[model samples]
Target: MKEQLIEKFENDMKKRSYFLRLLLVIDQFFNVLFWNGSQDETISSHVGRRIKSGKANRFEKLLCKFLSKLESEHCKKSLGE
Candidate 1:
């Protein structure tokens, strides 16, 4: 299962441009930190500091959309829906 997920993620990355791939990597880093119990606002502040405020919001929206798609796919596979 883990291997399949990694393969899928890698293939998805390959389809994206280098700039987008970098943003996704940064977003995933913060996501992992958030999962490890970091406060949401704290992570948001860090991202905002690292990226322009306007661009940060755009990246966040993109991240949310990507995450929603991945979650939907996972749920369908898990529940056989």
Candidate 2:
């Protein structure tokens, strides 16, 4: 029973981590798209700092690419493409 509980806890943690990452990607994407150019620069600088600080991970780049594609598709659809 104790082992089962530990397994379940680990699974939950993994799910939570994935969800948090998804939310972070969405938030960053929105900030990039909707913010003025100056604000976009701020966001870029913040991301640069994270990369410099060794806090950025490879998964984030992948997420960004995926989100960008989705955003493009959304825009195209909105334009009746």
Q: Give me the displacement of residue 15 in model 1, in angstroms.
A: 1.9
Quantify how close model 1 is to the true structure by its C-alpha RMSD in Å.
11.9
lDDT of 1 by residue, 1-81 (tens): 999999987997789989976775675566567644233223333443434434455665554446458675331232210
Best by TM-score: 1
Model 1 residue runs over 4 Å out of place are 1-14, 37-81
lDDT of each: 0.51, 0.51
In candidate 2, list every pair of residues with a backbone clash.
none
Give the CA lDDT, 0 to 100, for residue 53 in model 2: 68
Q: Could you tell me every candidate's TM-score relative to the true structure?
A: 0.31, 0.27
- The residue-level lDDT of candidate 1 at 43 comes to 38
**Deviating ranges (above 4 Å) for candidate 2:** 1-16, 36-81
Model 1: per-residue Cα lDDT at residue 37: 21
Worst 10 residues of 1 by lDDT: 72-81
